[model samples]
Structure formats: C-alpha cells, structure tokens
Target: MTSSSPLHILVIEDNPDLAANVCDFLEAKGHAVDVAGDGLTGLHLAVTQNYDAIVLDIVLPGMDGLTLCRKFREEAMRTTPVLMLTARDALDDRVAGLECGADDYVLKPFALRELEARLKALVRRASSAVTPSVLRVGDLEYDPALIRVRRGTRTITLPPIPLKLLETLMRAAPRVVRREELERAVWGDAPPDSDALRAHLHVVRAAIDGAGEPPLIHTLRGVGYRMMAPDAL
Candidate 1:
C-alpha cells in the first residue's frame, strides 16, 4: 500500500517521546509524518496543511484535543480525518471527542497494530465519496458541495461536520432517521455513544434554527429525528 504518494499524517501530542515514537512507526510504514507538541500548534498545522490523517492526543498543554477539534471545525473550517488518542477510556470522554468532530478513538497504552488499523480505517472512510451535493426540506436548501445553506433567499455558512449531519437529516426529510443510522452515516461503524449524536444535533440546530425559522430537525425523545418544516408540525 505504500506508493509514491505516501499518506501525510499529523501527530498532535504533548508528550515528545510518544509523538516521536508514533512518528517513527508511521514513517517506517512509508508515510510522511509531522509532529505538533501542543494543541494550538497541532490545530494550526491541521488547518494549514492537507493531511491524509491526524493522530490527536486528548490531553495537551494549551488546549485539549476535544476543544481543538471543535475549534478546527468552527473556526478554521477544517475537515481532516482525526484519530483521537487518550488514556481516558470512559464512554463520556469517547462521546465528547467524537461529538467534537474526531473520526476515531484509541485508548492509551494501546498496541501499535490497533493504532495503525484505526488510522487506516479513518483515512479510508475520509477518502470515500461523500453524499450528494445538495439537500432540501420545504423551502430550505443545503449544498454539501458548495457548503452553503439557504433558507428562502438567505444563505448560511455551516461547518463541515454539521453540514454533513444536516445533509443526512434532510435526505430523509419527513421520515424518522434512527439515531444509530445517523451515527453510522456520519461517524461510521465505531461511533461514540448516543449522547454524541445529540451534541451534533444541537450544533446543527443552532446553525439551522438560529436564523429565525421553525426547527426542522426534531427529536422523537427516544426514537430518532425527523426533518419537517415548523409549520407542518
């Protein structure tokens, strides 16, 4: 799988030893690697460069991994595939990481094989073809291709992950999209807990509904979500 166009990887870890070790391993596997010792630097590199994948550590000096991921999406408008590395194995931590836009997670003290496998999977998914370009519900329209969302004549700019989530919801508009289904669509098979789905939904809601329209993404409390015009309900 090592080709002339080697995969570019960014390792964002505060621990110099761990970062160097991971970089050495990935480099040995015929990949190009860059290391960032702090969250802020890592975020800057991630946004500025076009990396095939990112290995992100949860704990850092300036900013945490979760906050860094959110900031990258919200501020920098980055959409790189992220693999979160953390010692905290709690479900909540996992959910928080994924909700903030990480694509995969590996617990600390993990084997190199597991980390490599997760990295390959994340990159593979990221390289796959995305959903269609545009989605519509009632009079509102969202273009995943252009990354511009429109309600009536007004256009809104949404971050990448939220736009993807909104596209998934709008594709199944007027129908109840199960929580697990949405998770699979956005985060793949190894998604975090259900709370992560809710968190992303909250972000999406703020983007769509904050503009003075009825809520199109509705929760069924326990079942799932439905995209319907406010007037319809």
Candidate 2:
C-alpha cells in the first residue's frame, strides 16, 4: 500500500508506559504523534491544533475522555474523528462512547495491529471524503486550502468552525441538505443536539448573507438548507 499522508494523532492515556508505547508505535508508522496524560490537556491540544485523529482513553484525570470529547465538540466545534479507548468491555460503555462522538472504539488489551488498522481506516475515510481545499457557491467562494473567502472582489476571514459549516453548505449548493447530514458533515457522526445545527446556520448566514449582495444560503423549512446564486431562483 502507498504510504498515506502523515496523520497528526493525539493520544490521551494516563498510563505513562502504555501511552509512550502507543505514541512510539504510531510515530514509527510515519504518523506525527502527541501524548497527553490528562483529558484536559488533550482537549486543549485537540482544539488548538488540526489533528487528523485522536485516541482517547475513557478513564482519565482532570476530565474523563467522554466529557472531554463532548466539551471539544461543544466548545471548539471541531469535527476531527476520534477513536475511544476503554478498559471496560461492556456494550453500554461502547454505545455511550460512540454517542459521545467516538468514530471508532478499541477495547483495552487490543493488539497493536488492531489499533493500527482502526487508525488507518479512520484517517483514510477522513482523507478520502473531502478535499479541504476550496468551496464554491456560485460567485461566492471559500478556499480552505488558501484559508480565504471571497465574494466578487471582497475577501473574508472566518473562524474555523463557521468556515467549516460554510464549506459544508457550499459543497451541497443548490440542493437541500438535511440537518442530520449537515451535522455529520461538520461535526461527525456524534453530534451535540439538533439546536447546534441551527446556531451554526445563524453564524453562517450573518457572515455570508448579511453583506446584502444576495443570499446564497437558504433554509428549506423542515427539509434542510441550500446555497445557490440569487439569479438561480
């Protein structure tokens, strides 16, 4: 297999030896790895840095991994995929972890091979689905690759989550994108709540439509949302 792009991985495990071992193994596989002994520090790193994936332990100090994951989603609005690690093998724990925003889970005592495979699958899926380059909705444009946005001659700068939300909408321009779809696109499979989508939409509207050229992003009542040129109507 062709080596994929180096993925930045954050490991939040309290066990010093295990954490170091996992990090070392991932780094040896060409991934850039960072280790945090506590959930709070891991959350901070995850929010501030653009990590390809996170390996989080359920039992942690300062903050538990589940709470950290939820907090990260709520506060930073980050959509980075997470693989939750847990010593508990109960089905309820697994379900709860998934509900909390974990894309995948690996029970403790997992083989290194299993961990590597899960990480690879997560990263590959993330990399293949969307090109984080640019998004276009008629004359309006946002180039994530360049970290810039433009409507005609004017350029705009947006904070990360709002930009991500706008990009998701722009990618589905002219089509009514369902609320659930938007949540999965911008926040991953495990989303906060239904209201979160509305809040982000408001921010997107203010930034993209408030200027008054012509609103491109539109809500389709109960259906979802769409972005299209005003002339297209």
lDDT of each: 0.77, 0.76
- State, as a TM-score between 0 and 1, how close model 1 is to the true structure: 0.70
What is model 1's C-alpha RMSD?
4.2
Compute the lDDT of residue 162 as modeled in candidate 1: 60
Model 1 misplaced regions, further than 4 Å? 1-6, 24-30, 47-49, 62-79, 83-122, 131-133, 152-161
Per-residue CA lDDT of candidate 2, range 6-40, in tens?
A: 77889999999999889888889888999999988
Q: Could you give candidate 1's per-residue lDDT for residues 1-233 as a string of tens digits?
A: 33244688999998888888888888988889999999889988999999988899999988999999999877887787788898886666876776687766677887776677667766665565665557788778976655578888877654445666788889888899998889888667766544556655666776678777777778898798889987777
Best by lDDT: 1
Each model's TM-score, in the order given? Answer: 0.70, 0.55
Candidate 2 stretches greater than 4 Å from native: 1-3, 130-233
lDDT of candidate 1 at residue 152, scale 0 to 100: 85
Error of 1 at 83 (Å): 4.3
Worst 10 residues of 2 by lDDT: 191-200
